[model samples]
Structure formats: structure tokens, C-alpha cells
Target chain A: MTDTIAIGTADRKDAKTGTVAANRALAGPRVNGKAVVMTLYLVFLMLPIYWLVNMSLKTNTEITSGLTLWPRQITFDNYIRIFTDQSWYSGYINSLTYVVINTVLSISFALPAAYAFSRYRFLGDKHLFFWLLTNRMAPPAVFALPFFNLYSAIGLFDTPWAVALAHCLFNIPLAVWILEGFMSGVPREIDETAAIDGYSFPRFFVKIFMPLIASGIGVAAFFCFMFSWVELLLARTLTTVNAKPIAATMTRTISASGMDWGMLAAAGVLTIVPGALVIWFVRNYIAKGFALGRV
Target chain B: MTKTLNNKAWFLVLPVFAIVAFSAVLPLMTVVNYSVQDTFGNNQFFWNGIGWFQELLDPSKELGGRFFEALWRTLLFSAIILAIEIPLGILVALSMPREGWTVALCLVLMALPLLIPWNVVGTIWQVFARGDIGLLGWVVNHLGIDYNYTGDALDAWATIIVMDVWHWTSLVALLCYAGLKSIPDAYYQAARIDGASRWAVFRTIQLPKMRRVLLIAVLLRFMDSFMIYTEPFVLTGGGPGNATTFLSIDLVKLALGQFDLGKAAALSLVYNLIILAICWVFYTVMTNVDADRERVEA
Candidate 1:
């Protein structure tokens, strides 16, 4: 996939304006058609999220009273309850702690490996890369029991580090793959140039190469954080108390009594905020990241 | 760019190897150990050998029957998801604004669903599709159709599929959009010079250009859908009589719910094998296509 994108980019090595003018020409005749299609699609995308947000702002009685497109009587009790409660708020903190750790660990581990894979031909490199991907493909259900027993035995069962470490099985491979794609795009001459100038390997990597692929690092970090933040099963399995993610806390809302619809909606909204903020900050990075290219 | 022969790159890769091994290898070894053994609690065990594997493979047996049923359902779900999502995503991508602040606005909105945790996705759908209060359920029932997702198997299946599409189609669209953006406009200009029809331009230019990212989208969606658990488990609880129970949900039920470690471990191995086999097929097909493209270009 990266290869194909690279081919496309290589074809565009000519001046940028030539392509931009051609694109404008191509898109000109279909403006009306494009607008309608985009409008309809965005509405579909926004509707369910709107419904969830609507539910969160209303009282439980209003929610059960009838179906309405918008909240008739707004209330802040649900959001207030989540904010004031220890268990509810702490779930978010615990989740953030592990997700941050996992993203850092995964990206840091992947950097040098990606550099190696991109720049050098090591023995078993292909096999090792394929092996890493297989871990990503492995279902967490398969590892639930073993992970439980293993973490417990190691006395790291309920800590944030446990979930962070477990997530590396999948996230590290992904990080490595993305970073490798970006690194391969950098001309090998740059590394040779740095070395010829008497720069040490680590020094050269940190100072010269890192900034060159900073966008790639941003993309890789975004993905690592996204996957770790959203994953529920492994995170839930690895932690019971100290590191219980907000997703697990949402499940507790379904007690023997009944579901707490309003509270769950509120908590769900809060969980989405951090990701939305991250996406906003890295919105452009995400498009290039989705390219899976070294843009 | 010829890479130097640098076996010493192993040192650069060692940290990744250590961390991944500690997480992946140790737990996998545990799974392998349990698959071959049996126990009746209290740290006692018996060597079961191939007993569980034999039982799991025999369709006449209970565990075997459930496993195969769940496996078929999972494959069907992935097929349906891919069939609907890929073309729909491309259509949406084609319509997306190519410039201005609207592009940023569209990108963030399209990405909104992807960032929400999977369980919350299920919860939103479960409530959204409920006949009692869900807008989807209320609207459907008001339209005079017998639609009860909780009580009806078909509704349960439809709701789950729709929920999945709603949650994930954005991923495909975003990848396709990125691919589209990468295509040099010179291709389109050349097509226009040749008096190519819109369809002709799409078939010869856009589709081929999007192939690589499309492959990534397909593979990601397939693997994720095939192993789908948390969403369905939360929404349907694998019910309406196991209508929505995919392989992961079944494996979790066996491993955690019933505490049948031996059978569950065997099932897990079989499950992993199936995913690996499918992924290998995808990888080979993609490599062949890439090679073919290169050959033509040469």
C-alpha cells in the first residue's frame, strides 16, 4: 500500500500547481453532485452521536417518557454526577494513564526497529516483520485467560503497566509498520551524509532523522493511542481496580437493578472528548496517516 | 536504494523484540500448555493430549457444532460488511470536499466514530435501536414493521451489522480519500485529453490508483470483523439465540463463562489458524497484484 502511494507521489515530482490546476478542472463540473452526496453522508455520520448526546443531557424520566429528536427539558445532573463521583471520574484517569503509557512504550520500541527495517537488510527481517503482524491479528479472546493468569502470577495484574504492556503485543507491530513506511521514503543518502560528517548513530538519529519523519511519528502515536484507548477486552481483563478503564466502568452501570441510561450516556460522551481533542490537534496528520504514506 | 548488509541492526531492534516477547510469547506459551492439558481445579492437572482437539473437530459434539456455527457466522458477517462498506466508502470519499476548511470539518466528523470506544459504540446502537425508546426502533415501529432487535433473530443480526457499518465505514472512506488525494491530477488530465468518459476514467485511473490503500482497508476490516466480540457481546449478549455470536464471543464464552480451558484453548488455536490462513491469502493476492502492476509499468 505504501509502495503504491509512493508511486503516485513520485509521479507528482513536477511542480505542485500543475496538479492543483488539473484537480480543480476535474472537480469543477461535479460540484453540485458532490455537495449533495457529502451532505447526506455527514448527516448519517452525525445522527447516532447526536442521539447519544441528546440522551446524556436529559433526565432519565425524560428519556423514558417518549422519543424526541432533541431534549425537551435539559438537565446537567448526569454530567454533574460523573464529575463528582470518585469511581466514575477515576475510571477516566486510570484509562488515560494506561493509554498514555501504552502509546509511549509502543512508539519508543518501534522507532529503532522501523529504522532498521527501512535502512538495512538483517537476517530474518521479513520473517520477524510477519511475526509481529501475526500478533496484531491474534484475537484478544484467545489470550484472555493466559493473560489473566500470567499477569496475576507476575503481580502486575491490576496495575496500569500491565494493560500497557499487554497492548504492545498489537500496537507495537502497527507502530513499527507505519513508522517503517515513513522511514523508507527518506533518501538513504541523508543517513550516509550524516555518518560521513562524523555524527554518531544515536546523535544522528535523534537530531537529523527524527524531525524529517516527525509527521510519521505523530501518525504512529495517534494510532497507538487510538487503539489502546478504545480497546476494551484486554484492558478489562488485565485490570480489576487500580487500572480499570472507563469502558469497564460503563459496564458496571448494568447492575442487578437496571441500566443507568443517563449516566452511561454522560460517561460515554466524556470518553469521546479526549479522542476528539486529539483528532482535532492531529486532524491533518490523520489524513496523511490514513494514506499510510510518508506525507 | 540498496540496503547495506547490516546484521548489527539486531541491536536496534532488540527493545521491540524483548517487549513483544514478554507480552505475546509468554501468554501464547500458556495457551499452548493449557490446550494439551486438563484440570479439575486446585492446581491439579491431567495430560489430555489430543482429546480436546478431537472433540472440537467432531461436528456431532456440542463444542464442535457451536464452533463451526460461530465460525460460519463470522465469515458471513465479514463478507457482508466488506461488500457494503467498500463501495459506499468510495462513493463518500469521491464526494468529499477536496479543499478549504470544509475538508478539515469533514475529516474530523468522519473520524468521530472511529475514536469512540467499541463498547460505547455497542451501547449507542443498543439504545438507539431499542423499540421502547430508541429513535431507530421507535421510527421503524411507527412505520408499521415488526421490528424488535432484542426479541427477533433477524432484527438482532441486522442491528449488529448496521451498527458495525455505522462505526467502521468511515475508516474505509478515510483510507480511500487519502488514496484519491495522492493520485496525481495528471492522470485525469490525460484521460480528458483522450476524451475518456467519467466511468472510463474511474476504471482506468482512480480504481487502480486506490488499489493499495483499498487492500489495507479490506484486510483491516476483515480481521477486525471476524474477531468482533465486545460490541455484539454488549449489545445482544450473543443472544436472540446466538444469532450474533461470532467466533470471539463464542471463544470468550467457552474460556471465561464456562471455564472450559482445554476446549477453549483448542478453539483459540483453531481460530488463530483460520485468521492467519485468510490473512496469508490477502497478503499473497496483494503481492501478486503489486508485482503485476510493476511488470506492466516495466
Candidate 2:
């Protein structure tokens, strides 16, 4: 597990090869096997999304008349409908507003705790960390009733803040865990160095360490936003009709009138678009976030 | 210095901690309170002791109701999910290339489904499984399978299972792929010198190293699958007559749809205990296995 071949093999890829070898040469295949593998994965990954996107562009009649691999004459109607329709736009705003608020709250709370756990051994560090993770593991359905009662009694039910707060339970733990892992990689010496130079801890965290792991914090917040944005159970339970997300709106696809296939497909496509954009940018941060050091 | 928390660090994390604690503790306390109490419509509650627990656990009591049935279904669901997803994810990861933009691209694509919301996944499947109009359903039907998730139990189960596999197996593959990437060429070289077969190298070397992340993968997938609600709920509404109903769906039905708060609270507490117990056991076993691996290495 030690950092084997730390100096040579890694550098070889960057400097050597006057002839400019194939990209797959690094992994032992001449045809760039990684690209092939990645292409195959992209196909697997994009197929359903592609189907949803195609479905979204079509009219309802075209949608339910048995699936076509491609859309028959495209229409902007579904997308246009989502925007022009008051109910759809409100749900979209509801989901977006709360997701933003909750992500901010999660990172703000998690950063200090993660820094504390990473740096200082407090009175109940292990227990507190473990306790935080328990929330991460707790099923939302298990708490749905209590949340309804509690939020309703407090007059918070049906508010965006209710879902925002409920999501904070899981997202905060995740944010803390990811941030802690990132912070731990920074040596205590760095903190000592900053403070020895007369920098305050807050100043030090904000100015010194912040930039060092900006990617990590950004990564954690992206996840926070992602989870809260897509979350349905607690969000759905907490909000009745007024502040529901697009998820709840999509549920109305099923009615006595039968399924609204085109609209549902459009909604599904819209949801995936935001996530796709974030993941496209942060894909590298994700893999590095998954591991460090040698095997 | 290590002993001093300085109180100031708490300020840095206060935003997240306050939000999490507010959401977590009160609802939990409410559940605990109701698990031992009876409540009328007026919000007046009376101590019911462990009466709910006894009824929930008693086999002779059909009062076990759909709770027991949902639990059994969840167990089966979790089992099927693990069996299908783990191998499939491993294969997908193994088939992936080891380096360059290709590796990066694959990672991004694999992560796409994981990033999407769970309910949206259900919606996608819901539309996709329409025999009359959905792409998946139409294709399968074109191939001569009935495949209606809304009407048939088996089709409902199959569609949901396939949707889940499509959704989550990517996560396991990514984690495993990360694990594989971390392995230095030296160990693989040692196996090569020893002339070990690929399966032997995988089992004796790869699987052993992967044990840690594999534990994490299993625990995460199990918890998620057991707690699953939105996807199946969206797809089937726990229907074709309760075939796809799990604990979460039933809890939602009782608490929200039926407005039975007291029973919902009690049921929620039981549900939490099951997750807590399973998580504890899994964590313990994982830690012990890690310890065992350390000893063997020594």
C-alpha cells in the first residue's frame, strides 16, 4: 500500500516518448482500450437519458402510441409547457430555492465540525461522528409521521424550509464526512504554521486551507445540492400541495385520464440536465475524492 | 491543546449542525414517544407500554399486518439487489480501462445515474415501462413479453429491479474501480510471477483488498434498498395490489395517506431499530474482518 514507484512510472507518461505514443499505451492496450471502455459506458449511461430526452421532445400522442427509437416530429411544447404552466414553474422554483438554501446550510455547518474532527480530539469525537452518520443512515419514511406532526405543530409544514431542514439531516452528515476526509489530508503542520504566523483560526481556515481544498468543499456542496434537489420522500411528506418539487408534480401524470407520457418524460429529462452539467465538470474531483495514497 | 475544543470551531460548523440536529432529534423523539403511546385525534397521548412492539413481533397476531409482509419483501428485494448489482457492477468496473481521458469519461458517465434523484428514476421507468408507448415496454413487448409494470406483479418487480440495477450498480462499479486503480502494479506483478490464474489473483488479492469498500458498498446498497420508497412508490404506488410495497411505502400510506399518526410513529421506530441493528452488525463484522486481514498480513 506504500507509494510504490513514486518517482519514475508516473513521470514517464508526462515526459517520455518522442513519437507521441497512443493514449492507451499507458494501460497496456495499443488501441486506447480506456476510450473504448469509456465509450461503451457512455452508451450504457446515456441510453435511458437519451430515451427520456427523445420522449420529452415528442407530442403525447406520439409518446403513448408505442415507442419509437427516435421522436417523430419534435415539439417545444413540453418544455414550453413546464415554463408557462404556473404549477410546473412553481414546483421548479420550490425545488431550486430550497436546494440552494439547504446546500448553503449544510456546508456552513459541516465545515467547522469536519475541521474540528479532523484537527482536535474533542470530548466525544468518535461518538459524535458516529452519531452524525446515523442520521445519514436513517430512512426518511421512518421519520415521516413525526416530521409531519412536528412541522405542522410548529407551523412549518408546507414551507420550503421544512423540506430544506429535513434534507439537512442526511446532507450535513455527508458534507461533514467528505470535508473531514479532505481536511485530514492536510497536515496539522499547516494549521500550526498559519497560527504561528499570527493568523486567527477562522482567518486561517478561510484564507489558507480553503483554497487548498476548494475543490473538496465544492464537491461536498455539489453532492448536498444533488441529494436535496432530487430527494422526494421527506420533501414530499413535508410539503402538501403548495411547495412540492417537480417530483411531486410528475406524480400527477397518473390520473383517471391515464398517463401523461410526454410531460413525464419532459420532466424527467429536465431533472437529469442539471445533474449532468455538475457531474460533467466535477467528474475528476469525484474519483480522487474516492481514494488517496497507494492501494 | 488537543483536549481544548476552543468552542470557536463549533461556530464554523454551526450552520450545518443546527440544521441537521433540528431536523433529526425532534422527529426521532416524537417517534420514540409514540412507539410507547396511544394517541387520539386531539393529540392527547396515553402510554401504551410495549403493546405495539409485542403485536408487531407476534406471529399469531395478524396484527403483524402488512408490516411483516413488507419486511419480508424488503429482505427479498435487498437480497436480489445485492446479488444482481454486485456482480454486474464488478464486471462493468473490470471491463473499464485503467487510465487517461477514457477512464475519466467512463467515471463521469457511470456517475450520471447515481447523481439523478431517486424519484425521477422512478418516473423515467414509469414512462419507459408503458407497454403501449414506453420504449422499454414496447421493445420487450415487441420481443414477445407482456411486461406491464402497472398491472402485473412479476413485471412490476422486474421493471423496478431492472430500473434499480440500472440506477445504482454504477456506484458499486465506481467504488470498485477506484479500489482497483489504487492497487500498485507490483502486487499484480507478484501474482504474475507466481503464475496465479486471473480468478486466483482476483480472489486472493483483489477481493481481499476490496473487502473494505465492498463492506461499504453492501451496507450502503442494503440500507438504500431497504429504505427505498420513492422509486417503487412512484412506479407502482405499492401496487398491482401490494406486491412491490416495502416498509417505507407502508409507512407513507399510514402516516400521510391514511392519517394514522400513532401507528405510523410506532412503525417508524421499529423501522429505525431494524436499520440501526443491521448497520451495527455490518459495521462490527466489517471491522472484525479488517482486523483479521491486518493480523494475516502481519
Candidate 3:
């Protein structure tokens, strides 16, 4: 399927060059319109983020005093404070810890299950798959209190493990769903060939099959990381102090003195960095991943 | 693809099953337990079967009124989000550059909003839409339309809806772009040869080709919007007067704030059931659509 799309793209490139004059005449206005639409939409998307970044660079007094598109007196005090303070910087560490754990856990657990669903017809497989998907739809609000009790009773509360494990409620299902889609796209002949080659199931899976779906695994892990990092409700509820996510710690921006606009904007800006970094790593797979590999 | 029957495959699935069951089932059981029973301070409990559920469903009761109001508001919010996002997403996806370095740049920037923490998204909008300092709020006020999300219920609703659109529309667009990418140039060539109008090509070819991804996008948007909590909570704190208190906000208040476990549990169960029902419908439709497409191809 992907091969056909690649071929089609090459064909379009050839066609564009081949009929340059005629094609340009026909598509000129439409192309310009597309560029305009894209520019406007991208601007709409970036303006708010630009505002946040703008505020983060300014002093608290300047932030409250007036609106500024660009900071007149840029100061690093907010970023400096976050990096220097133990409480502030620790939140980022804590958030990264659980997000990493959850992504690893979700992808590892989902891998075998996804392979099973894709490669075999097991007892109640369809029902099981659907049931798993239903978990993705379960509201985090419904699970917050119960998770708090369950984790505390198990002595995992107020720890990164609690949030990581709790996050599995949704992330596992999602990983399995995405991985299954990617796995199903691979031909069954490969599995049969491996068997004919006298390969053990585990060896075939790890050495041969795993490499084939490496991008799928990357996509799944990316999604797992994205969800676990951004989720605040369960993360905040499960951990009060020691494992507080950067997002939860962000609430501290509301101090007794008043809202610390600069620090709040700084923390918000900082939260976007890890995500942006992750997106950069997975940029190629993102569109396909967002399709959950069904396409 | 064909699969061999192998019940033994369950072994491969056991780890996921165990972990998910531990995470999902155990907490779910706790919710069920809370739903049936009343609890006093120090966890003293009494039987309260059907009582909380009844109160939750009965509009005359205060609990029921709040639940129904939030449910309607949430449903309306989800509906409006879908109505706006799906069309806008398709437009953006259609406008995406077909090739070159800009593709990666567009995708990376488009995905940035999706990865931001929900509360940060709220904060961005909250700060961006403030009347005094927020660029959007300041600009809108400068236009001489009295716009204060902090004070006006209608403005609060609009701010939240717009914020959600900003955050999630990228997801829909990205999915649709994938769907569009999969279409072979042969289809376009054929349409061009036939001298088909752009709308004709889109209606007859692009839309049908995009059906699968669109369904996925719709299902995700609906579920996420319906369950939205952190963004609106941070942005409006459920508002000037419960104007933006969706289901999750109300549930958090009931469960955590008031410590009303029974009512919260009941609401949670009902809420889960509604989502489950909608999800089942979408799943059934998706499978049927897949089967139909397969049959047509065959």
C-alpha cells in the first residue's frame, strides 16, 4: 500500500514537470489559495503560543501592565527561577520519569498482544479487541478516586510507578490498537517463511518480525509518551508531592501575592519543550501514526 | 490477511490482559462498590442500592439537575466541536502542500498543539484571551465588542470551544492528511482526463477514500471532547457560574470536592455507559464499513 503511494507521488512529480505550462495555468490560482489557507491556519495555531512565549520573557510587572506582542525588556528571571528552584525543576524530572515508564510499559505489553491479534484467530479475539478499545473511551474522571485508593493500598501512591501504572488504563489499549493496525498491514507470508526457516516463534518475533514493524513500535511509543506526558488529572490525583508532574506543579503559579504570570508562562513554555522534541523525532511517522496505521 | 486459529495465542496476550485488568478492573470494581453503598466519615458504609442512581437520573433532584445540565452542555460542546473541526480539518488537510521540505515543517508545527499538556493549553488560551493582557481579549475589546470570558457566560463558552478547536483540530487534519496521502495519482489522473470539477472529484473520490480515517477522527474527537476536563477547568474553573462545567468537571467536584462518593460513582457509571454505547455504535459502523469496502474491492 505504501509502495503504491510512493509510486503515485513519483508519477505526479513527473506529470507536473511534463505538462508544466498547462498544469501551471490550471493549478496556479488553486495553489495560491491553498498557500493562503495554510498560512492563515498556521498563524491561528501559532499566535496563542507566541503570546505565551512573549509573556514568559517579560517581567511580571510588564505582563500585567500592558499587552505586548514582543517583550520590550526581556528577562530570564522566570526561566532562571524554574531551573534554579528544586521544587520547580523537580516537577519536570518527575513528569519525565512517569512518562518514560508508561511509554515503555505500554509498548512492551502491547507488542505481544498486538501480534497475537494481528496474526491469529484466538478465543473471543474480536470481542477482546473491542473491549480493549472501550477502555480508551473511559473517562479519567471516573478512575481518579479509585486509582488513588488502589494505588495507595498497594503502596504505589505518591510515586512515579503509580502514575505510570495508572496511565496504562488508557495507554495500553491505545498502543495495542495502533500496533495492531500496523501489524495487520504486514503480509502473512513473512510469518510462514520464518516458520519454514526453522525459526522459533520468540526468535522470529524478536529478530525478524520486530524489525519489520519498527516504525509501528516507534509510533506506538510516541503516542504512549504523548498521552502519559500530557495527562494531568490522574497524574495530579495519584501523586501529591514526591511524584507531582510538572503540569500539576504549574498550579503553584497562583501564589498568595497573586498570579505569577511570568513564572506561569515560563512553566507552560517549558512543558511544551519535551513534547516538541518528541514530535521532531517522530515527525515523519506523525501523519501515518495519527491515522493509527489504518490507512 | 488470513490468521490461523490458535487459542494458545492467549499466552502472548496474557501480560497485557493482566496489567490492564489490574489497572482497569480493580479500580472499576471500587467504583461499582462505591456506587451501591453509602459511605460516612472514616469509611463507615451502608447499603444504598439504586438510590444514588435514581437521584442522578431524576431531574427534580439537585444532583440530577446538575448531572442533566452538565450532560446537555457536554453533548452540545462535543457536537459543536465536531461540527466545526471536521470541516475545518478537511479544509486544512486539503490545503497541505503535496511535497517538499514544507511537508515536514507543516506536520511538526501542526502536531505541536496536540502534545502540550491540557492545562497549559488552557493557560495559553486563558492568558491569551484575558481582557487586560491577553492579545485576543485585548484585540477583541479594541474592536469595541464587550468581550470578557471571565464575566460573560456566552463568551466563556466561546473561549472554551475555540480553545478546544485550536488544540484538537490538528489531530483531525493530520489524520485526514494521511488518508489523502494514500490516494494514488491514478484516481486524480482519471478524474482529470474526464474533466471533472474539483468538487466532483472531492465528493466522488476524496470523501469516500477518507471515510475510514474520518470515522476514526470523529470517534476520537467525540470521546476526547466529551471527557474533557483539565483544559476548561484551568481556563474557566467551570466558570463565572457553572457555564462551562462539563461532565468531568462536575464529576471531579462531586467525587473529590464534596466527597460524595455514591453520587459521583453513580454519575461515573452512567457516564461510562453513555460513552460505551456510543463507542459500540461507532465500532459496529466501522467494521461494517470495512466489510463493505472489502466486498466492493473483491
lDDT tens per residue, model 2, A75-113: 989899888999987988888888988999888888888
- lDDT by residue for model 1 (B26-143), tens: 9888888889999898878799999999999998998899888998999999999999999999998888886789999999999999999999999989888989878889889999
Tens-digit lDDT track for model 3 on A1-295? 5434543554476476685444443354677889999999999999999999999999999988877789999999999999999999999999999999999999999999999999899999999999899999999999999999999999999999999999999999999999999999999999989999999999999999999999999999999999998899999999989999999898887963899999999999999999999999999999999999999
Span of 10 residues, lowest total lDDT, candidate 3 chain A: A19-28
- Lowest summed lDDT over 10 consecutive residues: which window, candidate 2 chain B? B1-10
Better of 2 and 3 by DockQ: 3
List, residue by residue over A1-295, the lDDT tens digit for candidate 1: 4434533453353224355444443444567788998898889878888889999998888888888788888999999999999999999999999999999999899999999998999999878888888888889999889999999998999999989999998999999989998998899999999999999999999999999999999999999999999999999999988889998998877792677889888988998999899999999877779866632
Quality of candidate 1's docking, in CAPRI categories?
acceptable
Best by TM-score: 3
- Over B196-261, each residue of candidate 3 has an lDDT whose tens digit, in order, gives 556777999999989999999999999999999999999999988999999999999999999999
DockQ of each: 0.45, 0.39, 0.58
Predicted model 3 interface RMSD: 2.9
State the TM-score for model 1.
0.94
Q: What TM-scores do the predictions have?
A: 0.94, 0.87, 0.96
lDDT of 3: 0.93
Instruction: Compute the lDDT of residue A200 as modeled in candidate 3.
Output: 99
